[model samples]
Target: MTLTRPETAATPPETDAAPPPRPEYPRPDRDRSERWVNLNGRWDFEADGHEGPITVPFAWESEASGVHRTWLERGVYRRTVTAPADWAGSRVVLSFGAVHHRAVVRVDGALVGEHVGGYESFEFDVTEALTPGVSAELEVSVTAPADKRAIPHGKQRSIPRDDYDGVSFTPTSGIWQTVWLEARGRTYARSVALRGDSLTGIDIAVDLAGDAPEGAEVTATVLGTGETAALTADGSGHATGRIELAEPLLWSPERPHLYRVEVRTGDDRVVAATGLRHFETRGEELHLNGERIYLRGVLDQGYWPDTGLTAPDAASLLRELELARGLGYNLVRKHLKFEEPLWLHEADRTGMLVWAEPAAPSRFSPEAAAAFEAQLPAMVERDGNHPSIVIWGLYNEEWGLDWDIPGSAARAEAAVHAYERLRELDDTRPIVENSGWSHVRTDLVDWHYYEPKLAVWKDFVARLAAGERDDFPVRLAPDFVVDKSLYGSAEVPRSGIPIVNSEYGEGFTSLERAWHLRWETQELRRHDRYAGYVYTEFADVEHEAAGLLDTWRRPKDWGGARPADVNADTVLVLDLVPLAAGADIEPPTGPLALDVHVSHHGRDSVSGAVHAAWLPAGTPVGVPVPKPEVSSGPVTAEPFRLSSAATITVPPPSGPARLLLWLADESGRVLARSFLDAAEVEPPNRRGARPGEFEDAPAPGHAWQPIAFDDS
Candidate 1:
């Protein structure tokens, strides 16, 4: 069922309707702790012959840079930087994190380098191209067709916020990433690839810049144990060998193991670490190594309000990955765009699983498919070595592309063909023919069930097992719904394949982008009949606000139950804006202080009444306001007033005192929850660590532990 591949779309035009190319920061300083070339700030800027302010790393359209909202059709940028005299005999490397579509680099009127691909790093060796010591003029010319549908671009919608002007879909141009100079010796290590296999403990490959030195002793030093393993290679600058590891420290969401690796060849040595593990799919579940590995993953578009497709820097990558890990997510499903290689590298180091997908082929013509096939091998070959990548998604929801299918038996035939093609190209991983389960063509049957309805999902499962839902998970023409509880717009009357929730949650953000429509409002048009609810999203992309957290990374108002969009993209209360000197405060007269108190609220279920428990830490021997009346129950009065005493204060304690409260209904039921709010009676007189502990708050993170409400 393999359909002939399509032709590549014609190269983008030379029209004067785009911005000039820019540099991207795909690589960073090996040390990574200090000293950085802030490639993201203040570059000479312009657009379509219009004078613009210098905005280095940020896109022309983002608010972070005070640049105008006006985006560019095409333009050039010029910046001046003098090379360090010590770099006399070094090769000058111009690196770019990403520039939307195409780019060309110019230095002192000499064409230095050019790059393609909006989601990969491209660099050029410019040792003999630039001046030394004196400030050399660096000019970058960029041309990008902002909103051409013909291109394989995705989700770059131009929905206006306060005003207009900026990148139409986020502008592109010079140095979108970090650009710096790297001094290479006669023989230097270019990059390293660490792969851990089930049979083999781990395999290490090194990409070198110059010729491999003869009789070079390549030694790999494992951190922690200080165990050094040595190996030899023929000549292509690659050294491969497996270590004698008894039980490899596997990387999982619950346990992330990072190993430091040092490769020494000749006199040059490179040090780095990688997380080791294996990802595969069994009969009904995805496996990490040999165990069932549930992917509490977030759908990350990887778009930044300020940086567009490119993250601000590698540190930004660390922040997102670590935050996701803290929230209990083991996987990050990169939707649409293929990330820069460094992002994959970061995933390798940070113990996060990755499901990489190329931007869908927009125009579903034979030519487009062929072009996609041509480009796909490169994408897989270059990024495939990463162990974090578990699956390859062939197509997403929007594209209506199909393959070898005809007549009544055409259901998943086309998808099966597409899935097999990807498998043929690379058999190491599973291929999801259609991401949203639009076509159940591959090993994993993917379904997106937003706003879950348990009955609908169960019935759908029944149908797949028995063939046809019959009267179970019902179907409707314009849409369908078996259970009124589910949320969806398209309903499939019959179902097949192993259920995988592709899209479930929606209406993510408090910010603008895409607004959330309630399940009832959409009339349960086409919801899922699946096994799980993957939920719409975990964080807000630039315009797509339906996220577990707002753009600021703060959790949304979910009645404080938590785990409502809990994994990944969650905001920590510790990282919140405090009410007092903490929030947008003017300089203080003295030390910052706050009245700290804790109060618990709930029902005394057995008593059918309210009860309160509170502990205070900062209450001095008060002269007045003694015996603060306190009550714990549903706020009986307006403004959610607790039936407690005058004021609740913490008792003397070294740590934050417990303020537990209980509320009950007339029938002894919990009656839901009651009102209880704590306030700062007075600020701590002195600064630094407080004497007592605090009333425990929910742990800030993205992990999901299903809450159990015992009716037992």
Candidate 2:
């Protein structure tokens, strides 16, 4: 395969100015690494047209790839690996953690394996094919289409200009992940099904391809909670039994409880975890553990700058889950992508609910559908045991399906018929028809719209959630508000990172991005979205300076990144149970006419303290509109800027008020105003959470009653 990598001819002396990359991610990862060999460090690489030294795995266009800007639509990778010394007599199985789209694998030039899916694990049994003690050279050829339907590619923006702003995304292919060899015993278990049934107890099932051992005793045990069971199985490698738990804990955004499972035979042991709960949609309500559960979810496109699709390490992956949990979000809609098994494991162990999505193909024909069917199960079978995954976002924004599919008057009926198939495939999880679309059969109506983008339409949110279903979270930040107002578009930290943050806060800004928008007329053309300066950013990545943090996960280049503050939309809630940090506000006793004061940061908008009441989620607490006022001073409180800095200060209320103040910006954008001193800041969800266990919940010196769980 003559790969056209022109960059390889420029290698200098071995001791160049560039520092060598840190090869090790972390050694403690005993879960995903045990069954495979580490094929990560270095492999002999050559390009199509140029035969020279190149880094394996990383694409030639990447800095790690050691290649220049020369590009190729197709490429090949070759590496030689010898059988492990310990596996002198074992079966050597070659495994590719991931190979984009189309890859052909040959061992010693003998065509041994071919896999079509870009985002799945593929393996070939080379034990019988390769000679003993012989070094086997494996060659893999990869081809990527301009816009392939079968492959699941994420946000890979191509370069549009020759002059490098360094914001361009490089293309990828070949063995992107670890390509290693493993040894397998006869009749090894391929996959295990672990279920924590609330009613029938725990159901354990194992599936194997090879001949099962006669009288093989299958033992299943739950780690933390004392639950164990054993059953003798026949030669089919089939076994079904139940383990008993004393008291089962329900899994929720507030309390995600996972119990470890140990499955074993004479010599094999596989360990994983599952929770006892159910997630289904009944009528208008999404039911979990046989009760209604509201999912405060954010959309997360799992992408990083330096690493591309792969995270820096598991720490980076956990950061995604932890940041969402910190923001009080209960669910994360894993948008348009299927993450690696380790990601799902983190969600399961950490207790964040995952809405797994398959990459939406731009085009889907009968052949494409067949390809999807073949690959979808592999992803599900590997991830199904996870309790954290509650919903499967099979199709997104008409990726495979189309606009006309949902545009027909029979939209709900067509959707309902299509939904039956997903339900049949995975009975345990819910299916979202399309994110940000309304379907009568949808368990949840996924919607998306930028604040200013939808501000003109007015019915954007209503139309998106406008469905016949009686139950569903009608309005939630409108997929999230893309704040684009040049004056005061804002994306504040809604706790931490949202599971999704499907929408931006307000407007956006960067140095030259302004001119680009001005030329293309994207935000400029529409005279909206303030030219892609959406209100808030997670942290500024590359040239996109809207993020709360920077591209490196360090605080941004400048210091405006606030990773500590928690933000509320309509009301800011604080748990001031006496000793909590910033819990010094004294409660008022008399019938005080609390005035409302609003303000902006730089301009100093509001002046005096205003009196306001406290209102919980379902409670009825009202305060008259402060009409319009603008004042300023050294006083902490200020008058609200409906357009930009919308901060409101409230004094103690008259009655037994639990509600804080309600605020509306000039444009009626509601900002959160919470009155409860927070009880606990961050409660570990590993153990099913107890109500008052948060660090902030029982602060020093204050007598307090626990607030109803606000996690979800």
What is the TM-score of each predicted model, taking all chains together?
0.61, 0.64
- Runs with alpha carbons beyond 4 Å of true place in candidate 1: 1-38, 69-71, 131-135, 158-175, 211-219, 224-239, 265-268, 310-329, 339-351, 370-388, 398-428, 438-443, 449-498, 506-533, 564-712
- What's model 2's TM-score? 0.64
RMSD per prediction, one decimal? Answer: 16.1, 16.1
Angstrom error at residue 593, model 1: 50
Candidate 1 residue-wise lDDT, 352-440, digit = tens? 77778876444455554554444465565457656678778866643425311222233244345566667776776777776653444
lDDT of 2 by residue, 29-106 (tens): 123235446555455566567555455445555545555323455667777777766665555677666766688888
Instruction: Report the poorest 10 consecutive residues by lDDT, candidate 2.
Output: 698-707
Clashes of each: 90, 83
Report lDDT (CA) for all predictions.
0.47, 0.47
